[model samples]
Target: MMYDVLIAPFVEFEFMRRALAGVLTLALGGAPVGVFLMLRRMSLVGDAMAHAILPGAAIGFLLSGLNLIAMTVGGLIAGFTVAILAGLVARMTELKEDASLAAFYLFSLALGVTIVSIRGTNIDLLHVLFGNVLALDDQTLLAIAINATVTMIVLALIWRPLVMECVDPLFLRSVSRAGAPAHLAFLALVVINLVNGFHALGTLLAVGLMVLPAGIARFWARDISTMMMVAVAAAIVSGYAGLVLSFFTKVPPGPAIILVTAFVYLASLLFGPVSGLLRQMFPGRHLEA
Candidate 1:
């Protein structure tokens, strides 16, 4: 009776398994990306790239008739192209990195909306914004696994140089020629993780996944390695909690997960033992005193 009433709903459900898998994969890959993004001070780029994938996904849907894999591929290509163009524009002109990213993402957002409207397929625009995690299938799960593996491997290989560049770019550049390659490779991995994660979390919240936990971790730890580890642990725990909540409550997984993470961020912000808002706000009073 317990098996029929309780376990069956989650254990036998394909969508539930797929949604859990999606959450796990994205949290694992995105946690490190979040740390490096913080170090680079280019965290906004993740948000911009996430938005940039919209038009490509919409276009893919229009052409391929809603094949999620094909549409995701389209989004991935579009996202990478935007990143490349933004980098080139930033290099060739004086617009600066933030400005270039803004321009690219804004243009992509407009183009995506226009194309979807013209296609007249009755597809909801909000799906691209918030994502539909419950709709994830085996094929999408496989794609996410592949993307996660590649992202983790690349991150592991480039971890040291990336850290050096983040801390002391000039010194690293003066010391070794490999810093430039490491920087480029790291950006490439960010693009891939953002695109892959978009399948579950969409543009708005996917970027949040890459920023909020890391930001929260910074409040508690002084060491970069410790901060990354803490952020990953936080992400994995909150992700699972969100998935289970969504499964039981019939809420959308992406927003539910992000909302949970946001709560964690808020707690960290206000009460983290090291550099919390409360400590900063009331410098004189101590919890013991």
Candidate 2:
């Protein structure tokens, strides 16, 4: 019965196998980026960036009708443009970074919707907004895999300076010139992952696999490296369980996966070891000083 429930689906179906592979690669790149976003207190920026890519994706869809490369390039361009513009706006104006990002996010979302409406059907818009993971093709899968590889490699290259920037931006800037470049590289990584995610999870829900696992990891881990590991594991489990749930229940695969992460996040909130409600409610014995 367990085999029928768990193992049979992947073995019996190619789509299931493809979905699993796509999500595995997604998790590999996204989870660590998420952990760093949380560490830097920029979780919402991830969401903003997710929205920021939409207009470019919509434009790609308009121009080429769902070509993965076109949409990915569009998203990358749009994401980078907004990131840079928002930074400039914040630096030059009275508006804060968050406000600048929020403003651009709204504009991007509105523009994306308009462009999608201009040339695409409701179904196309739905597909763009909420991805269909079960529909991932070989080209899409390959793109996702390549994106994950690049994200992992770039992250490794920028790990030290990025971490230092996250922990102490001022100290990093004071001590080394790597700070600004590291920040830009990190932002580019975020954009790249979100662009790839747009293909698998759509623009709206793409940030789920990225940010949610990181949030869950916070409950169990106090260190960055351990938090990233936990987040990746959580993303993997959520991806598998979500696919299984979708198979049995007929829920949309993309949303199903994100909902599973949400459930896990709630569970972690209540029962996790670090700062969960249970830990707070039932305090441990104080250590003797």
Candidate 3:
């Protein structure tokens, strides 16, 4: 039963193997980014940024007809542009970063959808929105892998300052100029990872793998390092379970994977050890001398 349920899918089908690889790679690279975003209180910003990548992707699709490289490049460009522009708006105007990002993302999402609708069919748009993980080709998988590798490397390099900035932004800024650069680098990593996931999970669903794992991890961990590990583990498990569910039920892999992660998030909310509902409702026994 286990073989038929889990092993057989990957053993029997090459696409299943590729899908598994794609999502697992995403889990390793994107999950930590999600953790940082959560720590920095930018969870909604991640969602905005995910939508921000859509215009570039749509333009890429309009020009190249679903070419992976084109869309990836387009997404990177759009994501970076929006991030920079929003930062500038926040810095130069009265608006805050979150509000600026929210406005830009909404505009970008609408623009992207319009561009795609202009030249592509509804099926093409659906593909952009929901992604087609089971259809990932060798080239797309390679791109995702490369993106993941870059994300990890850059993340490691900027770890300390970034964490400092997240924990105490004013203190970090007072101490060193690394704050701004680290912030930019972190945003770049976020964009890159989102673009990476875009190929396999679509623009709308891409952020799920990135953010949901972090949300689940928060209930289980207190420190950043442990939280990141837990997030990655949760993402991988969710990805695997989601893929298997999609295989048997014939549902879309992207949504299925995200839904599984969401379920885990809910469960963690209810039963996780660190800050679960059960723990809150029923405190542990303590002994006093």
lDDT of 3 by residue, 60-91 (tens): 99999999889999999999999999999999
The TM-scores of all predictions, comma-separated, are 0.89, 0.98, 0.97
lDDT of 1 by residue, 250-287 (tens): 67788888888889999999998778989888776557
lDDT for each candidate structure: 0.80, 0.94, 0.93
> Least lDDT summed over 10 consecutive residues: which range in candidate 2?
165-174
User: Model 2 over residues 156-199: C-alpha lDDT tens digits?
Assistant: 99999988987888898889998878888999999999998898
TM-score of 2: 0.98
| lDDT at position 132, candidate 1 | 76
Error of 1 at 272 (Å): 1.2
Error of 1 at 276 (Å): 1.1
Off by over 4 Å in 2: none
TM-score: the better of candidates 1 and 2? 2
Candidate 3 least-lDDT 10 residues: 180-189
